[model samples]
Target: MEYKYKLAKLQYDKEKNEELIKRQRKRAGQVFPKQLEVEFWQQHLEQARHNINQYFWSGVLIYFIITVLMITGDYWIIDRNFFKHDFIHSLLGLVNGAFCLLTLFFFAHYKILRPYYAYAAMAMIFWAIVSMTWLTMTVHTEVFRHQAMMIISMIYIMGFVLTGVKPFHMLLTGLMAAVVAMIMLLTLYIPIDVMVMGRVLVGSTVVGFLISKMLCTRERMIFLVMHQARLSEKINRIHAEELLHLSQHDALTKVSNRRTFDEMLDSYFEQARHDEVPLSLLFIDVDFFKKYNDHYGHQKGDEVISAIAKSIKDSIRHMDFVARYGGEEFVVLLPETDAHGAYAVASNIFKAVERLAIPHSQSLVDSNVTISLGFTVYKGEADIFKSDFLQRADQALYRAKQLGRNQIYYHTLQVEEVL
Candidate 1:
């Protein structure tokens, strides 16, 4: 029973996030949706850049060594008379290494050109696969041609491992290698065994295709799940904050309600006691509000209350605040204020409500809407606790009703002592 709710909550959240990702993918025309734009690109680029940087120098060194060995081997050991055609083919092979280095440099120096890296990387990989086939074309030896074919397959699969943090890049490179290798073998006059080479090519490509399909599936699943968790947590936070706000406020009047007022009362009292400051509270009631609601209908009553609340809230100083204590009743709390300050605020609010001129045909006081107010201003008295001020204000409001309907009254300290 202890961890039951926690496990249930986790399950519920996972399901909800999965559904969110599914719906979002339907709407996502691009690789990354608008909300996850920053995260998606940041992760993708970081992985690509890290791998390119880590392997770039080592891969370049290997390419340079291979290029030098090819040129030197043709001239020194194999061919007694190396012609211009051999020179041209070796230079052409060296050009592929140059393109590889160029791709590395583009990634290192130019960050703003992020969109081009994928194309540049793909082109470099495609060149690596095809360049060896072309380089061995001029060499009429069976051994060199066979060795070159093996090198082509090796580089083809290596391209897959080299492409990091991408979904389809490895697959794309693998497909390109297979297509170009087969096309060159069939069409061009490279004196190699068609049967043996074709079999090896198909085998390696099947492995590459399997590797590509498997890796792409796993990485793509992880990426989607990661994004869903990030976005769902953000959405949950927003909803939680909204719920907290709704709980603390009156939905109808858009003001702080009784629950919030009660919390503030406790806090303000503690602060006032510590600082040896005065605290004042004003309670306001709409005069004959029940009759007003009955006569003018509840909708009009709601409008009148809203208008009166706005007037009261606007008329008060920023330091002093108000809340709807209950139905047609509002409380204003003023800290560090004496009797004079409380009276002034109460009087202003009373006048402000009258000035609204909302036709209150059922109000007993006047033709327009009016309010009766009673307030209590308390110094830091050791004998008095926080709740004493509320009682004093209530008693004062009762006396005001007994006397008349639409006037302001002050519950003095002398009356409290007398009681």
Candidate 2:
């Protein structure tokens, strides 16, 4: 029974690990919608580059100050006849100064710098060399051992704080630094407690590395959450805009539907009345449409209607409105248009339909498909109701159909003052 329990537990752990690995792979493959992945990384790199540039400048300044002090201290030591290594100190100061200038040059033109990972690794190695050289010199002098240890600890802490690398990368760097320090200490023949002090320094570096990894992991988690939230917001916004477009447009004709037409008409009517501008509404009918549908199939009828809608849309101005009112019927609202303009638009629409030249043997007026349009122009009249205006245009449409199928009829609303 005990063996069975252990086997079951092992199986469960294996499944859990597999599931975790699968989820991690899936998360790594995830991408933001609408090219936001590219944009996000671009923005992140720009920000990080700017910050790194600032850090480089600050480091240069600090190096400059420290080099100046080291030069002054070397000269003082020479004057006092205290240390014979003043020449070595002078060379190190010169080297540090040269390095400061090199760092400045690289950061100033970081734009042309290629292979970012290589650059980063090279920079870390350079700084590590400089730090180890200075620390090793201080150890050889044996004048400020306590101060040197404090400085070394601070260097490790700063490495954890300032290096903008992944936790794994940081761990590798820390290990390299520790190994280099251990090698340097072992080679240098110091008459002190080398073993105990070496262990203490190495252990401290390990602790600092662990702390750096924890901090980097937390920062990465926060960044991922924020990125996910931004992606979610963008998706929701695009989905909402798509839904709005679908609601307002006709699925078959790909034009404004009846509901959208009614809303636009009311809005344009109010605006025209307010501005005292002329507004024309055109009621269009496909002549002998039922007969055409009877001759052709319903699918063909749908295609014909769609073509008509497209022609009308192509003929009208952008500011003008056209919508599918119902089967074989359309409405157009032309704001700020006089009778002449309205008549010109209607004529263009007629010509556009004529251009299609769809065969219609069932149409009594012509062997080709044609449309009749009736328009009513309102000249800012508060007395005439919207329904009445539409009714008059509809009446004119009836008259066009009564007389002949393919033609245009119009009714102009005139306001007379009762003096």
Candidate 3:
């Protein structure tokens, strides 16, 4: 009976394990689909933001130019007799100028109403056409006044079309078409003949279309050039950053390379000398690395070196500098560190490497991988030149290797000036 019970328990556990595995597989499938949905929405939002910013600024600049032109032309060019005491005509010009300036101010600040700003601009343009038409009707027999009003109306309509004003674009186009037709019908009332009105209407239509096309083309070209310039500036910045990284980093371990280390050492040494402070240096070498490379293949050897480099970097202070000093060797620069402080830091590095427990069967020192470190501390009136300081650290490293390897040695320079 006990054996029978055990067999039933085993069957129940097997069924439960299979169910858990099936649920895990279903979850994995669901995760990928949800990630794709999130990514699509993120991209769409970014594109919408870019388009809104572009159109917002472009609309602001266009409105400012138009407002300035209208104010200047109204003040200087148009004759009051053409409007003929029509207060509504003068009021329309003022309204058009004010609305354009207001639209410019709102876009320069709010920016969220970019799409609707175009519609506001189109409304101002409509008022402009109405004002011009009233002026034209008041002086229908005066050829110059009649022609100027028609030209202004046609130019305003072209502005509507170029800005993609949609319903207003169609409305303005229809209004211009109707005005041209009426001018044809009313030529009998004018002093000018039918042929002259026909010529004026045709000329106005051709010129309006041409001006609109030219403005659209010029705006598109300007946008393209500006976009390219921004892209080039971004690319150049990234390239400069990459070049800086290459100059300062080791190719293999991705730590500071020898050249950067030397440069930094010189700079810190100067600062320490000026501030009357101490600076320390540690030179580290991997023990029996060549034998380890011979035992394992070169590829595994590279992995070991990379792992050791990471260990050394992890062991150092964040403010200290560590760099690859050549094959299976490294250097550390500790600013404001004395001999005792540097020794403690080097001992920590030695222990951290041992904790990695990488196999080194042919190692001359131990069964596990280990490193030897030599440190030198520089204080006021040290017995060494800058070059001698480096040499002393190298000498200590050699002595540590000679004395059995996998140990830390400390050296202090005593400088005596020869009289």
Candidate 4:
């Protein structure tokens, strides 16, 4: 039942992820259901940060080279008529470029940068617009001013794309840059055609917005598909593990079943026949279990069995194996154990079940529920058959029953001990 519940939950999650992926395949899928959209971004943060590092760090080297070229151009004048070099405007451009590099480096190295990426993107757009606008005003030639404005337009678009923020954030940052640019133009009173400036800004904003939407759609699809594949693999692994457990474990007692015990016994018998190590088997049966069930009810009998199984498990070492051999009977296989070790383990198991103190008035052995244990250890002997070794343990169990129940009997080929 526990395994069933877990398998069901995994299936549901897998279906849900696939559904989300399908929804995203449509045109309007960019806008996800509110809470899920938030979760998506949170999960994508590591990838987002990595994309930022690649773009912004690369921008750092580009900007540094631009700064160097700007400084050199202060002395060299190839076109005096088309380009008027104003030191103030050049200084402003150089500062913006250097500041962009340093800011990206600081965010990349210093702190948790994912949360602040949108803000950093907006800052990149705003500063680039300010410096370029001032430089445009300082230029007297239309060629120089037009070129500077085109660069500013690229900056506005590249800010969001390179940052890899959500489409909503991209639009918001673009609109904010346009609004702030108008404010700067009005206050600075830079002499230029306002109509041309408006056209450039609007065109750049529209182009950037469309590109961001397209890129975001592709990214969202890839993320969903990758995660869905992982979810499917997880579901397969979990289902296989649960099925294997069911095939090998007893349903009622949650211990290894009779089939598992039989397979293990055969393997160990073979090992003992050829190897130097000894193989020990302990046969366990509840005392007066039939009478106990008749008096206390079958439910009570089941509870007793489960409790006794647990107690037996806790009493033995991790290397030992315990299984429900049949109704009200169990078997423990101890590998590499000598006579003394097998005897001690059988003794502990008998005492531990007795300590459970489950009420069993039908049990003639004791007022509370108790158990009988019979164990035998077989040292490697080429002369003896594996069937003979198992028969020895069964014979000990019959001997314990004959002497009266609720006790332990240890028997070997040449010796017998009672405890």
Among the numbered candidates, top TM-score falls to 4
Candidate 3 regions exceeding 4 Å error are 1-84, 91-119, 131-148, 154-210, 218-244, 380-384, 414-419
Q: After superposition, how far is residue 174 of candidate 4 from its true place, in Å?
A: 2.6
Better of 2 and 3 by lDDT: 2
Q: What is the lDDT of candidate 4?
A: 0.77
Candidate 3 per-residue lDDT over residues 285-344, each given as its tens digit? 999999999998788888888988899888888999999989999999999998878988
Looking at candidate 1, what is the lDDT of residue 180? 83
Q: Encode model 2's per-residue lDDT on 80-158: one tens digit a residue.
A: 4435454465555457545644553464446666336334633554465436445444433454454456555655555
Which 10 residues in a row give candidate 4 its minimum summed lDDT? 75-84
Clashes counted in candidate 1 amount to 0
After TM-score superposition, what is the CA distance of residue 326 in candidate 2 from its true location, in Å?
1.3
Runs of candidate 2 with Cα error greater than 4 angstroms are 1-22, 25-144, 167-235, 381-385, 415-419
Ranked candidates (TM-score, high to low):
4, 2, 3, 1
Clashing pairs in 1: none
Question: Residue 245 deviation, candidate 3, in Å?
Answer: 3.7
> Residues 65-173, candidate 1, lDDT per residue (tens digit)?
9878877876654444555656666576678657765665576447776556666666667777666666765465445566666766676565555544243655566
* Candidate 2 clash pair list: none
Question: After superposing candidate 1, which stretches have Cα over 4 Å from the reference?
Answer: 1-43, 46-210, 225-246, 316-320, 336-344, 378-383, 399-403, 412-419
Going through the candidates in the order shown, the clash numbers are 0, 0, 2, 0
Q: Which ten residues in a row have the lowest lDDT in candidate 3?
A: 28-37
Q: What TM-score quantifies how close candidate 3 is to the native fold?
A: 0.62
Better of 3 and 4 by TM-score: 4
TM-score of each: 0.58, 0.64, 0.62, 0.74
